[model samples]
Target: MATRRIISTEKTILDKDDDDISSPVAGQQQSSNTAPAVPMDVILKLLAFTFAMVVVPIGSYFLSVNTFFKGNSTYAGGLAAVMANVVLVGYVIVAMNEDQSDQLEAKKKAGKKE
Candidate 1:
């Protein structure tokens, strides 16, 4: 009987391109606490996204709706697309509001702690 050994040629490489401020790495001093900045960044990103999605479609809808599509149900695809955009913006704003409330709750908890 002969015993055979199996070897993996794949090398396990850990990428350090991602910087986690919470994890203190040896030989390097991490600067001030960056936790507060994260929520603000997320909020700003959402706000920008919300405005882009809402404003662009609205501007184009008005610009083309008058000259292009005459009736609402005349073309199924055109009407469906308009309705879809309206529903999408509605859901996005709901999500944005939820995130805002969650951030407020986090701030309240932090305030209670201090």
Candidate 2:
């Protein structure tokens, strides 16, 4: 009786290809080439600028009214001024929160790499 040996060239080549696919070399270059995108801080700055632009006009209106009336008025003008300032404050808060969230997201992404 004679003993025969079986060899698989296809299986060996497939195993080699799989090893190369799983290696870190292929993914490293791709990840390095493409970085994550981040929104510009200029957008937040523009929002704050817009808020200031709006607030200034409203404030000037209140100041003019106060000066014209010698600081005397019914509750309406005062309420309006307060409301305008409150709106300005809200815009500021929103801008700040957006900036903070962006920073946090960037930090989280950085942490993921480590």
lDDT of 1 at 112: 100
Per-residue lDDT of model 1, residues 1-114, tens digit only = 999554465333332333453467787876777567556766876687677666766565665565667644345446546755876777677778978999999999999999
Compared with the true structure, all predictions reach lDDT values of 0.66, 0.70
TM-score of 2: 0.39
Name the weakest run of 10 consecutive residues (lDDT summed) in model 1: 10-19
Question: Taking the tens digit of each residue's C-alpha lDDT, what string does model 2 give over 42-85?
Answer: 56677776876677656756775667666665554665566667
**TM-score, one value per model:** 0.36, 0.39
